[model samples]
Target chain A: MKIAMPDGSRKEMTVSVARIDEILKELNINPVEVVVAKNGKIVPEEETASCADELKIVRIVHGG
Target chain B: MLNDLEKKRYSRQIRLFGEDGQAKLKKAGAFIAGAGGLGSVISIYMAAAGFGKIRIVDCDSVELSNLNRQVLHWSDDVGRSKARSAKDTLEGINPEIEVEALEETISKENIDQLLSGCSLIMDAMDNFSTRYILNKAALQKKIPLFHGAICGYQGQATTVIPGKTACLRCTFPRAPPVTTFPALGSTCGVIGSIQVTEAVKYVLGFGGLLENRLMLWDGLSCSMDEVACMRNPGCQDCSALIGDANYKQEMSK
Candidate 1:
C-alpha cells in the first residue's frame, strides 16, 4: 500500500494488518494524534485499511 | 429593520446577504475564547461584521512580547489586562455592537455560564485543554464551533456543528504537547479570517460551511490543503449526544 504523509511525501509499505490504526502503529505514528483517510474519504479509527490503494495521514495540531 | 446608520455602515455586506442576513447577524451572539493573536483577528472581524453581541474572555496581561501578533494590545497596554485591551479595541472598531470582555480564566466550572445565550463559539485559545472545554460546551449546547489555530507560518481551521459533523475530539483524540510556539501575525489573520467567514455564513444560513473538512494553511509554500474528517462513534466528548433526536434522524438515513 502507498501512504502519503503531511509533508507531501509518499512511502510504500507492505503490511498484513487489516486496521488503519495498526498500520499507523507499524509506521511509528500515533493514530490518536493524526487523522487518517483512505482513498479520499475519512475512515474511522477501527476501520479496515487493507483494501485501500492510497492512504493519507495528517497531523492535526496548531499553536494559537 | 435597520436604522439609517446601520444601513450605511454595513452597505457593502448588506448587498451580499441583504437586509435579512444583516438582521440575522445583528441578532446573534458570538463567544470568543481568547483575546490573543487569533482572538484579536476573530473579534475584530466579528465586531466589524455586526455580530450584535460578543463575549470575549482572557486572563493574561499584555506584555512587550505579545505586540508582534496580538494586534488588539498596543505597546502602551503592556501592563493592562488582555480582555480590557481587546474590549477597547473592538469597541473602537464598531461602537454599534456590544462587546463584553471578561477577565477570567476559562475552565470547566464557568464554561456553561460564560457561553450562555451565545449562538456560536469561536476557538481562539492557545492551548488544547481550553479548546477541549469550549468544544464540550459547544456540543452540549448544540452550537457550532469555528476553530482556528496558528503557529509561525502554518495554521489550520475547522468547523464543528456538534453531532452533525466531526467534533474536535473526533478529529484530534489527543492534545499535542504544550509549548511556547513561534508565531506570526499574518498566519493568525489567515486562519482567523476563515473562522469569521464561517461564522458569518452560518448566521446568514448560506454558503458551504467547512463541515467535515480540516483546512491547513502553509504560508511558506503559499499553499492551502484540506483533509477530510468524520465523527468517531466512540468519541469521549460527543458520543453520548449522537443519540439525540436530530443526530439519530441523520444517522438513521
Candidate 2:
C-alpha cells in the first residue's frame, strides 16, 4: 500500500498494523513529540493506537 | 434608502469607497462578541462606516476601570450593561443603522443562536474558552471569522474561512497555557482596528481577505509580520467535518 506523508511524498510499505507507533517505528521514526495525520485528518492521541489507515505524519513540536 | 444628510455625513468615506461600497456596508450584518477594549473600537468603526445591522454581545456592566479604553461608554454609562451602552453609543454615531445589544455571555449552548444569520463574526473576547467556542461555531456555520488577540504591547489577528483556511487551533492546537496576561488599552485599539479593516474588506468584496495569514503587530518593537500559513488537514475540527461527511455517505443504510 502507498502511505502518504505530510510533505506530499508517497512511500511503498506493506504493514498489517493499525497503531501509529508501529507505522512510525517501521518508517524509522521515534514517536515522541510527533503528531500523526491519516489521510489528511488528525488522529486523536487516544485513537492513535487503534486507528488504521494509509498515514501522513506531522511533527508538531520544535521551533515556534 | 440613504438621504442627502446621510450622504453628506459619510461623504469622505463614501467618496473614497464609492456608492457600491457604501451600499455593501449598509447591507452587511456584523456580530461582535465582547464589547470590551477591542469591541469598543470595532463597534465604533463599524457604526461610523454604516454597517446596516450590528449586534454587540457582552455580559458585563461598565465599570470605573473601563474608562481608560472603552471610549464608547461614558461616566453616565457606568454601572450599566456594556452591551446596552455599546448599542447606545453605536446608534448615537449613526441613527440610521440598526444596533442590537445582547447583554449575555456567549456560552457554548447559545453561540450558534447568537451568530446565526450574521454575515461575519468578530471575536474581541479576552478568554480562550469563548474564542474556541466561537471558532467551532464559525467553522460549523461556514461563516467567516475575524480573530484578534492582544497582550501587553503585542497583538495578533487572523481570518478563518471554515474549510478553506487554517483555524486558530491549527496554529495552536491547544490554547496557550498562560491565562491572565497583560494588555495595554492602545494595543486593543491597534488590533481591533485591523479586525474592523478585515471585516469591512470582507463585507465590501474588496481585494484579498487575510486568509491563512497571521498578522502580528508589536507596539513595543514597532514591527509587523505576515506569517503565511495553510490549512492543517490534521486539525481535529477540519478532520471531523471531513469524517462526518464521509460517514454520512457510507452509512446511507
Candidate 3:
C-alpha cells in the first residue's frame, strides 16, 4: 500500500490491515491527532483503505 | 443609503460588487478573536474595505517580539494591550467604520456575550483551546466562522458555515500538541487574506464558499492545495445539531 504523508512524501508499504487507522499506525503516525483523507474524501478513523487508494494526512496544530 | 464620503471611500470595490454589494459589506458586523499575527491582517483589511462594524478581543499585551507578524502594533505601543492597539490602528486606517476592542480572555461563559450582534466570527487565535471555544459558540449561534492558522512557512484556512459545512471540530477532532511553533508574518498575511476574502464573499452573497474544502498553503514551495472535508456524524461538538430542525432554523437567521 502507498501512504502520502503531510510533508509531501509517498511511502510504499506492505501491510496486512485494511482499516485506515491500522495503516496509519504502520506508518508510525498517530491516527487520532491527524485527519486522514482517502481518494480526496475525508474518512472516519474506522474506515478501510486499500493499496490503490490515494491518501492525504493533515496536522492541525499551528500558532496563529 | 450611502453618504457621499462612504460612496467615495468604497468606489474602487463598488465597481466589482456594485452599490448593493458595497452596502452589504457596510452593514455587516464581524467579531475577531485575536489581535496577533492573523488578527492584524484580518481586521485591518476588513476595516479598510469598509466593514460596518468590527469587535476584536484579546487579553495579551504587546511585546517587542510580536512586531514581526503583528503589524497593527508598533514599537511605541509595545506595553499597550493588543486589543487597544488593534482598535487604534484600525480606526486610524478607516475612521468611517466602527471599531470596538475588548481586552478579555475568551471563555465559554463570555463567548456568547462577546459575539453578540456580530454576524460572523474570525478565528485569528494562536492556540487551539480558544479556537475550539469559538467553534462551539459559532455552532450555537449559527454564525459563520472564518478559520486561519499558520506555522513557519505553512498555513491553512477554511470557512465554516454553521449547519451547512463541516466545522473545525469535524475536521480536527483532536487538537495537536501545544508548543511554541515558529511563525512568519508573510504566512499569516497569506492565510489571513484568504480568510478575509472568504468573509467578504459570504457577506456579499457571491463567489464559491470554501464549504467542505480546506486550503493549505506552502510558502516555501509556493503552492496551494486543498483537501476535501466532510462532517463527522460522530463528532462531539456538532453531532447533536446535525439533524435537528431548530438548528437549521437558527442557521438561517
Candidate 4:
C-alpha cells in the first residue's frame, strides 16, 4: 500500500500491522503528533488496518 | 457608512470586492489570543484590511528574545506589555479600526468573556492547551476560529467552523510535548497571513475556507499540502453537534 510519509515523501511498503497504533509505532512516530488516514479516510489510532490499505500520516506538531 | 477618509483609505481593496465587501469587513469583530509572532502579523493585517474591531490579549511583558519574531514590539518597547505594543502598532498602521489591548491571561473561566462580542477568533496562541480552550469557546459561541501555528520552517493552518467542520480537538486530541520550539518570523508571517486571509474571506462571506483541510506549509521544501479531516463523532469537545445539517448546508453556500 502507498503511504505518504511525514517528511514530504511517499513510500510503498508491505506491512503486517493490523492496528493503526502499531503501524504508527513501527514508524517510530508519536501518535500525538500525527493523524493517520487509511485509504483517504481519517481513522482513529485504534482502528484496524491491513497491508492492502493505503495510508497517510499527517504530522501536526508545533502550536506557535 | 464609508466616509470620505475611510473610502479613500480602503480604495485599493474596495476596487476588488466593492464597497459592500469592504463594509462587511468593517462590521467584523476579531479577537486575537496572542501577541507574539503570529499575533503580530495577524493583527497587523486584520487592522490594515479594515476589520472593524480587533481585541488582542497577551499577559507577558516583551523581552529582548521576542524581538526575533514579535514584530509589534520593538527594542525600545521591551519592558512594555505585548498587548499594548500590539495595539499601538495596529492603530498606527490603520487608525480607522478600533483596537483593544488587554494584558490578561486566557483561562477556562475567562475565555468566554475574552471572546465576548467578537464574531471571529484568531488562534495566534503558542500552545495547544490554550488552543483547545479557544476551540471549546468557539464551539460554544458558534463562531469560526482561524487556527494558525508555526515552528521553525514549518507551519499549519485550518479554519474551524462551529457545527460544520472538524474542530481543533478532533485533529489534535493530545497536545504535543510542549517545549521552546524553534521559531522563524517568516514562518509565522506565512501562517498568520493565511489566518487573516481566512478571517477576511469568512467575514466577507466569500471564498472557500480551509474547512476540514489542514494546510501544511513546509518551508524547507517549499511545498503546500493539505490532509483531509472530518468531524470526529466521539470528539469530546464537538460531540454535541453531531448532526447539525442545516447550519452546514447554509454555511457551505
Candidate 5:
C-alpha cells in the first residue's frame, strides 16, 4: 500500500490489517486527525483494506 | 418588494441573482455559532450580503492575541465580549439587517432557543463538540448547516442539508483531538468565504452546494482538494431526519 501524507510525502507499506481502522490502529494513526483513502476512494474506517490497497492518509487540521 | 434604497444597496448582487434571489437573501436568517476567526469572517460577509438576520454568539472576551485572526475584534476591543464586539462590527457593515449578539456559550440546553426562527446554522466554533451540537440542532430543526474549520494554513468546509446530505457526525463519527491549533487569518478567510458561498446558494435556491464533500484548502501548496462523504446509515445525530417528511417541509419555510 502507498501512504500519502498531506505534506506531499509518500511512502509504501505492506498492509497487515483487514479493516482500515485496524490499519490505522497498527500505524498508531489517530482516526480523528486524518482521513484514510483507499485506492483513491474515501471509504469509511470500518471498510476493509487489503494488502493491495493504496492508502492515502490526509490529515485533518480542525480549528476555528 | 425592494425599496429604492435596498434596490440601490444590493444592485451589484441583484445583477447576479436578480430581485427574487436578492429578496430570498433578504428574507433569510442565520445563526452563527462563534465570534472567532471563522465566525468573524462569516458574519461580515453574510451581513454585507444582506442576510435578513444574523445572530452571533460567543461567551469569551476578546484578547490581545486574538487580533491576528478574529478580525471582528481589535486592540480597542481586547477586553470586550466577543459577541458584543462582533455585533458592533456586523451592524456597522450593514445596519439594515438585524444583528443579535449573545454573550453565551452554545450548549445543548440553549442551542434550541438560540437558533429559533433561523433558517440556517453556521459552524464557526473552535471545537468539534460544539460543532456536533450545532449539527444535531440543525438536523432536528431541519435547517441547513454550513461547516468550516481551520488550523494553521489548512482549512476544510462542508455543507450539511438535513435529509439531503451528510451531517457532520456522519462525516466524522468521532471528534478530532483538541490541540493548540495555529491559525492564519487567510485560512479562515478562504474557508469562511466558502461557507458563505454555500449558504448564499442554498438560500437563493440555485447553483451547486458543497453537499456530501469536504472541501480542503492547503495554503502551503496553493491547492484545493475535495473528499467525498456520505451519510452513515446509523448516524446517531441525523438518522431520524433521513426519512422524515417534516424535514423537507421545514426546508421550504
Candidate 6:
C-alpha cells in the first residue's frame, strides 16, 4: 500500500492499521499544530485515526 | 459647493484617505453590540463617517456611572435606554444615515436577528458571556466580528474573519470568570477606535485586516503590540462550527 503524507508526497508501504500521527513519526515529521483532511474534507480530531487512504494533512501556524 | 460640502464635512479625513475612502464609508453597514462605553464611540464614528446603516443592541438603561465613557448621553439622557440614546445622538450627527437601536440584549437566541443584513459585528460588550455568544454567532454566520475588551488602561482588539482568521475562541477558549472590572474612559476610547477602524477596513475591502493578530494596548505604557494566534483545531466553539462533533458534544448544553 502507498500512503500519502502531509507534504503531498507518497511513500510505498505494507498495509498496516496505523494512525496518521504514527505514520508521521515513522517519517520523522512531528507537526506541532495540524488538522487532518482526508480526500479534501476536514477530519475531526477524534476521527483522525479512522481516516484512511489518500489523506491530506493541513498544518495551522500562529500568524499575525 | 457639493465638493465643498464633502471637503468641509470630512476635511480632515479627506486629506488623509481622499474621496474614494469617503465613498466607501457611505456604503457600509455595521452592527454594534452594547451601546454603553465602547459602543458610544464606535457608533458615533460610524455615523459621522457616513455609514449607511447602523444597528445597536443593548438592553440596559443609562446610569450616572456610564456618563464617564458613554459620551453620547447627557444628564437628561439618563434613565433612557442606552441604545435609544445612542440612536438619537448618532442620527443627530448624520441624519442622512439610518440608525436603528434595539432595547434588547444579544443572546444566543436573538443574535442572528440583530445582525441580519449587517456586514460586520462589533463586540463592544463588557461581559465575557455575551461576547462569547456573539463570537460564536458571527463565526457561524461567516460575518466579520471585531472584538474589543477594556480593563483599566489595558485593552485589546482583534478582527475575526471566520474561515480566514483566528477567531475569539482560538485565542481564549474560555471566558475569564470575572464579570466586573474597573475601566478607564480612555481605555474604551482607545480600544473602540481600533475596533471601528478594523470594522471599516473589513467593510471597504481595504488593504488587509488585523486577522490572526491580537492587538493589545497599554495606555499606561503608551505601547501597542500584536500577538500572533492560530485557530485551535480543538476549540470547542469554532471547532464545532467547523464540523467537529466531538467538541460539539463536549460543549453542548
Candidate 5 regions exceeding 4 Å error are A39-41, B242-253
Best by DockQ: 3
Report the Cα lDDT for residue A54, model 5.
78
TM-score against native, each model = 0.93, 0.75, 0.95, 0.94, 0.94, 0.73
lDDT of 2: 0.75
Sorted on TM-score, best first, the list reads 3, 4, 5, 1, 2, 6
Better of 2 and 6 by DockQ: 2
True lDDT of residue B108, candidate 5: 96
Badly placed stretches (over 4 Å) of model 3 are B246-253
Checking candidate 4 for backbone clashes, the offending pairs are A64-B150
Which should have the higher TM-score, number 2 or number 4?
Answer: 4
Residue pairs of candidate 6 with colliding backbone atoms: none
Worst 10 residues of 5 chain B by lDDT: B244-253
lDDT ranking of the models: 3, 1, 4, 5, 2, 6
lDDT by residue (tens digit), candidate 4, B139-245: 88899999998888899999999877899998787887787888989999999999999998998788999999889899999999777878787899988665576
User: Over 4 Å off in model 4, which ranges?
Assistant: B243-253
Clashing pairs in 3: none
* Candidate 2 Cα deviation (angstroms), residue B126: 0.4
Candidate 1 C-alpha lDDT tens digits along B37-147 = 999999999999999999999999999999999898999999999999999999999999999999999999999999988999999998899999999999888899999
lDDT of 5 by residue, B1-253 (tens): 7788889999999999999998898899999999999999999999999999999999999998899999998889999999889998998989889999999989999999999889999999998899989999988877899999999999999999886788898888778799999989999999999999999999998899888888889899999988787778788887776567776564345
DockQ of each: 0.58, 0.04, 0.72, 0.62, 0.70, 0.03
Better of 1 and 5 by DockQ: 5
Preferred candidate (TM-score higher): 2 or 3: 3
lDDT of 3 by residue, B33-57 (tens): 9999999999999999999999999
